[model samples]
Target: MKAKLITLAVVVVALGGGIALASASSEPGSGPPAIGVVRAVRSGTDIVLPFDAYRHTPAEINVIERATAVLARDCLNRFGLHWAPPTVDAVDTSRPTAAGRYGIVDAAEVARLGYHAAEPPDRPSQPQPPLDVLMVYTGKGASDVGGQPVPEGGCLGEARRRLEEGLPAAMPGERFAELDRELYLTAQADERVQRAMTGWRECMAESGLRYADVWAANDDVRWSAPEPTPEEIATAKADLACRTRSGLAGTWLAVETAYQQRVISERRKEFDALATALHARLAHARQIVNR
Candidate 1:
């Protein structure tokens, strides 16, 4: 039996929102401005950027989850209810998924997976807390379970507050996430990047695939098959070829990196301060989990 890969479907949703950035290069292949290190063409599975430093690693995310469980458990204990950790959406503003950010740069990956995220096995389902416990946890019903008072928004909200205490005015997030979200939009709107996409589209058309853009090609309903289809594989291969041939990958990366440099330089102090606060919060979370 062949092993199946999970698609996660998050790639398209993450790439949907974008806005134009200030004008730059006539040449899409121009190198990013000399502000920070520019990375080589990378696989969709290997995307790492300057702002990634601020994003939580898998381990760090684990620590955060554990600490939240502990704190929520403390609140639930007051009401004589047990709290099993539920997987909450990312409270920390980590950078969004980067899989389709540049519109499919990895040929081998697309050929094998076809615009799907190369994620691990499906996660085990989290244990659900009882309805009474949830009412207190989410603050949806009564203020208190039995007699113990529930914190504002219940335990989850309290845990979030505890985690975010002492951070800057920006609650729950920092500047890096804000900039990362904007950078992609900016790059997408760039003239050079747009020209490169035109080239990519033309290449796809020649291969008998009609797509308005890279995302359109990736979102074609046919790829929604339970597994990669012959057509999907062929189209993915052509997409990769077209990206390289049209300079889409190079141009987008350059434009995005340049924007990152300008923003990081301009907000170095604020970014640095936010980073320090984040590390400090993680340290506290570590202590909570250690207990």
Candidate 2:
């Protein structure tokens, strides 16, 4: 479990950290969301879940990436390499939110993209660093590069070390993700969600779209096109209307929220520890970016 959590923490931090240091330090949230099932309803994008508090915010991601770049840049300079750090920007929203967990929550997005992925931001590509720089940046599991001793995991590894300075051996956030996945699967399989999906299927059938459930509808292969076809748009629009009418989203979220609450209650100590570690790690990353 300790090894797994450390790996998870590394993945989370690698994906990046969140926003302003003042924001990072001012309102730290640690584990086990306190909001009730009722208040959690209709929350933004319906993608939110109790476990979201333990996840890294977009601003945090920005800070992590920026700090990593800064550290990498400094390390590369020792070998007479001129490094231009890649641009790092925080996103407005975090992904894989509970919204899509139940499928097709946003009518507007579905109407526009029709299950196709939203276009990614246009970031101008930065020039790739030289081979020697790459070797130094990643450490490439080497003892030294250009006769200068390389730190374990390279400079990138060093930045992670600094950011995670005070974290426990096991780190925290990843286990939430692991358990959240389990809970999500568990919640959806509940009889209530199964019944709700039945109603949703019937609703979709009225429009002649025969799908086993919401998941089937959302995963329709035709929607994978580079562009949404007119047929796909119509189907998606119908899928959205049926979803609203059947209350499948509402039902699924309710079930999931309840499951999340149960888990939080059961593992309060574990979650609290993870949340605290996340806050501390973010604080360290923010300090790096500002410095």
Candidate 3:
């Protein structure tokens, strides 16, 4: 199954030395504030689950792709064509939070790799397969191939259909993007988040940095340069220090957690359906891979 990937707006920083920093928007009156869910609490903190938990791991995704490739290869072979499964790259989709969430908090990484991390070598681009091969694999409106009518859905689609039998047609993580957006907007108006942002701003001021918010601190033109300037590095260090001192990331996390709990309660049914479908798809994919 194709994993549903969503970008989370609320950034939670899991810092080193046991400091979990959090921050939230201080903008006033964006929309109605989120209400807390009564039954979503566990030991005072809201029981919020990371969305990545339901996603397929890189290894699992590779397995699915390999299975699909195998099906495609066999279909092409029937037409006296030799085809090899393309080498699939595994994407790391397991990070709990997005990179650069706290804006250059990783001093070591910044010093070593600058603004960007080293990317893996890309797969070699291959030319399009012959028309007969394409017709068998993709069902590209060929009347007949190897004296047999091309199967409905083509080879690739048939493989996916088999792998996703008894599951919903919708992609995994489809509803999560909408849910994250709603939670983020609602969190911005949360009273607790506003108070936390105020404390964060004051902390930054005390450190001789005058920024309205974390976003503003990150918006400097220095950051947009082809390379990181010395000023940008120093500013990033200060930003991390101030955020840590104010506990901005931790505070924002608490408020956002409550909001997410409420969202989970409201969307429990949809979440469950998505989870079940994804599990079924993975199971089918595993069966295909193991065979």
Give one clash count per candidate, in the order shown. Answer: 1, 10, 7
Model 2: per-residue Cα lDDT over 101-159, one tens digit each: 56556666777776665554676667787777787888885677677888888887886
- In the range 1-291, model 3's lDDT, one tens digit per residue, is 111122353221111122111222222323334534323121112223354444554565666677777766776676677777776443443343334333333545444433333244456776687776777788877757768777677877666655555666332343444455555656655676677667778877876888877777666555676666677666666666665565555555556666655444555565455566666666766776678
- In candidate 2, which residue pairs clash? 16-61, 17-60, 17-61, 18-59, 18-60, 18-61, 19-59, 19-60, 47-98, 47-99
Q: Which candidate, 1 or 2, has the higher TM-score? A: 2
Per-model TM-score, in order, reads 0.77, 0.80, 0.65
Candidate that beats the other on TM-score, 1 or 3, i.e. the better one: 1
Question: Which should have the higher lDDT, number 1 or number 3?
Answer: 1
Superposing every Cα of model 2 onto the true structure, what RMSD results? 8.3
The TM-score, computed over Cα atoms with residue i paired to residue i, of candidate 1 is 0.77
Candidate 3 pairs with clashing backbones: 21-249, 21-250, 22-248, 22-249, 22-250, 23-248, 23-249
The segments of candidate 2 whose C-alpha lies over 4 angstroms from its true place after superposition are 1-11, 14-44, 90-99, 141-143, 169-171
lDDT ranking of the models: 1, 2, 3
Worst 10 residues of 3 by lDDT: 12-21
Error of 1 at 103 (Å): 2.7
- Higher TM-score: candidate 2 or 3? 2
Model 2 clashes, total count: 10
Q: The CA-based lDDT of model 3 is what? A: 0.54
